[model samples]
Target: MKHRTPRGFKRIPAWMFHSRLPVDAETRLITSYLLTSGSANHPTVSELSDALCMDAKTVRRNVYKLEELGLLKVIRRAK
Candidate 1:
């Protein structure tokens, strides 16, 4: 299991800070959080909202944007 804490040191790619992608600040923030914070494929939206201090709806929207760019895949867990 990934050893995650409420806050901890995370390795982030330098490219993220200097990428040429036409992503907004929020998209970049979401990408950074996922790269450093989320599970391999299970970054919770609630966790993202709490950490980033943004609304869940906003989080979902940015996530969708990231998905559309083909940066990551969203695998919904079975209910």
Candidate 2:
């Protein structure tokens, strides 16, 4: 599935920046990294893990949190 940016926003996957709840520096840092270094060229989790020194699974989980907050969308593949 293609993850297109929502209307009136950069394609940058930055949900933490404009979150309703306050986000910590670590989350903001990760969001910034994703916005700059990430591209459709690679998986978001992979890029985030490398930049934040976190496991890809952890990145996936946090991104889901962003999705749940209506800040972004998560695309799922057919099993």
Candidate 3:
């Protein structure tokens, strides 16, 4: 299946790479992975990292950025 890049994520700026806005590449990547992980109803860092081929540490760090910008909810991690 051909995968289309999600909307609102085209031509993101290098300075905004860490922004929570959908236009940011890292943000878009993490968010996109979460959106497709069947975890939108209960998003988790590990699942998103697995889907994105990123490390948990990076996922955790970026998740913090997303949460700080009010783009994502960061509930406590599951045991």
Candidate 4:
């Protein structure tokens, strides 16, 4: 049987890689991973750390930096 890829896989625009935005290597990698994850759900710091093979604290720090740069936004949902 032929294997099938999952749906909702999106391609990161080439411009993002070569844009004027001052994004670092780590931030860009994390952003790309999130974009291709196929969901609007946000991943936790632990998840990001595990996926990126970086320390949780490091992931949290980078996430904050991304937020500061307006490259990533956090939306709160009521439970």
Better TM-score candidate (1, 3): 1
- Tens digits of per-residue lDDT, candidate 1, 1-79, equal 9733335534434554456666776776776667665454566889889988999999999888777766654222210
**Which regions in candidate 4 have their CA more than 4 angstroms from the true location?**
1-22, 74-79
Weakest ten-residue segment in model 4 by summed lDDT: 70-79
- TM-score against native, each model: 0.61, 0.47, 0.54, 0.62
Question: 3 or 4: which has the higher lDDT?
Answer: 4
* Model 3 lDDT, full chain set: 0.59
Error of 1 at 79 (Å): 25
The ten-residue window of minimal lDDT in model 1 covers: 70-79
User: Residue by residue across 1-79, what tens digits does model 4's lDDT show?
Assistant: 9633335434445554457666676776677667766553689998888877989888888788777765564222210
Please identify which of the two predictions, 1 or 2, would achieve the higher TM-score against the true structure: 1
**Taking the candidates one at a time, how many backbone clashes does each contain?**
0, 0, 0, 0
RMSD of each: 7.8, 9.7, 8.0, 7.1
Question: Candidates ranked by TM-score, best first?
Answer: 4, 1, 3, 2
> Compared with the true structure, what per-residue lDDT tens digits does model 3 show for residues 13-55?
2443344355445666775555444435656777677767888
